[model samples]
Target: MNSVNSSQNNLLFTSRCPEVRDAQWVCQKVKNTFPHISTTKISAKMADIEEANWDLYRKFIDKPEYALLYNKNPKDRKFLRLFAWRRRIVKRIHDARESWRIGGKDDYHRVNNVLGQFKYDKLGNCGEDAFMAATILRINGVDNTCTAGLKVDGSFLDHMVCVFNKDGSTFNGKPNKNTIIIDPWVGMADFASNMFQKYKNVFSELLIGIKPQSEITFRNVDEVGISGMERFLLIMKHPELCYPNSAREFMRKK
Candidate 1:
């Protein structure tokens, strides 16, 4: 059974999806063209690459089969309990584990922070994708790039993305015009101020009854001060800590 599962996973990864291929192409193109660019040009070009990665990821997940399997529609809650949904979800989780294990041998149980591993596998949910996007930005000389996620009432809201502090300004209660957010999961990258509006207009279906910016605390993963392995173990033990929201509490307890 293990061998059969491994074979199936190998086929899944070996046969590159079109979206994954396109994302890799964009990454390679950026790497090739980046060296000849000026500082100002580099930022714009890097944004394009980040946007392209986000677009491809969106395409990958928006496919009917994939979307239906992971449907979040409130009306689908009953259907989700059905064996068909359970089987598919379980299979996906298994596949993700296999991919993570093979790609991240050094950190098998932790999030794959190595860029090469992510590029090779091209399979992860929001958190991993956010980490990949932030790493890409940093590698290309972008500063203050970090993974950020929302927290409400001391619990994580199950979303994360790459945030760029373009002007090194601290985020207070209000959105800063210079704050850029790149969400590969949702296929958007814009100023934090503009993104708040887009969150309502564009991502309303996914976000649903969006919380006010003041109520939503954006936690940067870098500030968590825990090793990836330790963070992973903490989340495994206290699943509430799986999201970025629980990081502060975990630190406080430490």
Candidate 2:
């Protein structure tokens, strides 16, 4: 990892780092467009951000297919069989999307990762939420703001979050005791320890059938090799690589 750090730094500087560039664009846009947000107290700003319902994007996109199946006769055995088959097909398509590898076929169902686009689309999953939150914090003068990824049970890279200095101090990669974590996906922001306790319950619910053993690890986007939009899409598609792991785990449990 140490040997790659230099190249990583170079990548972060050159055209290879569109994610970083996009984040900067978001910060600048927020600063220019929403200057009032930065003038408010930090707590107030965070609370205002918490009110946003961006997770609706996921809910909207994930609605099951074959809604007409629900209108079929409940008493008919054939209808039941066909409905069950439709459900299986829906689950299979979802699983295929989740398990898609980086170099596999192009993913047309990519989540909105371009942070600047969030202003207009108001649609995104955890990655977009984290990206926007971290950039907003920076625009609001939290110089230590960092977009972090979470690995559950030591393997599944299934969540994204924003970490920043609680006392408004600048720092490098990762968070310390002085840092606070803001998870826009769950609409909560608190000190690191408190946030994790709150998030554990939510995580358990989100990843049904896979009980997390309290093993949560965080990594900055730079450390994960997600340097561009294409890489971000690949990461987002796989539960073991990015957000919302429930479907994959549920299928595995069955």
Candidate 3:
């Protein structure tokens, strides 16, 4: 039945149909992007959620989530930390195993924003991995940023990680310095570290000590694969690089 024009439930009318449709849309998007059932199932679960659950669903949004990450509430900050991570890699993996293994494969995709559940999450999928990581890091007072980076292969715009202006330098919240591109989402660390050491002058030319800006582009962080885990290992293997300050010196000038 058509919803009434004067209805107070505008959210219920036009938006409701699309929730189911979006689930269908997410299914199509995921299926088209990833062939394996393991990867594509995320879209399937996203499709299955009840429209009323949208409120909870939006909490998982990186766009709003990032803006709110700095809210003064200690509870909000702490929620980001505990759910993000209170332990190290080996321990995180151990704790995550039971949860990941829960419900067999189905629970994996159903697991959102809850930390350490998905393998691709390690590569920084947020709801899958990166989001959880950033949430935890922020809570720990590490100062982090979550944004998206396109692979430049195919049209898929993937998620990536970055440290905020302050976290990357001793400068503290001053964005004028070069913000490092740490692609935790893909494990890219995507900076040209070697090139910087070689050019050296690119240092002055690159960052110019100008306040840097970063963003997520609003795409939901959902990529899943073993590659994500590989990237996670690579990052853990290099805490100095992951630390943000060391990385800030190398954002590509051009």
* The candidate that achieves the highest TM-score relative to the unseen native structure: 1
Range of the 10 consecutive residues with the lowest summed lDDT in candidate 2: 34-43
Which residue pairs in model 1 clash with each other? none
User: Can you give the lDDT of residue 39 in candidate 2?
Assistant: 13
Model 2 ranges off by over 4 Å: 1-71, 74-116, 167-175, 207-212, 222-254
Q: Per-candidate RMSD vs. true structure? A: 20.1, 18.3, 21.8
Predictions ranked by lDDT, top down?
A: 1, 2, 3
Over 74-122, each residue of candidate 1 has an lDDT whose tens digit, in order, gives 5443333332433454465456556556645432234333333344533
Count of steric clashes across candidates, in order: 0, 0, 12
With candidate 1 superimposed using the best TM-score fit, by how many Å does residue 89's alpha carbon deviate from the native? 4.4
lDDT string, candidate 3, 216-250, tens digits: 12233222222344445534543432323432222
The runs of at least 3 residues in candidate 1 whose Cα sits more than 4 Å from the true structure, single-residue gaps closed, are 1-86, 98-122, 152-155, 168-175, 209-215, 223-254
Q: Which run of 10 residues does model 3 get worst, by summed lDDT?
A: 207-216
Model 3 residue 155 CA deviation in Å? 6.9
Per-candidate TM-scores read 0.45, 0.43, 0.25
Residue 144 lDDT in candidate 1: 53
Candidate 2 collision pairs: none
Candidate 3 global CA lDDT score = 0.33
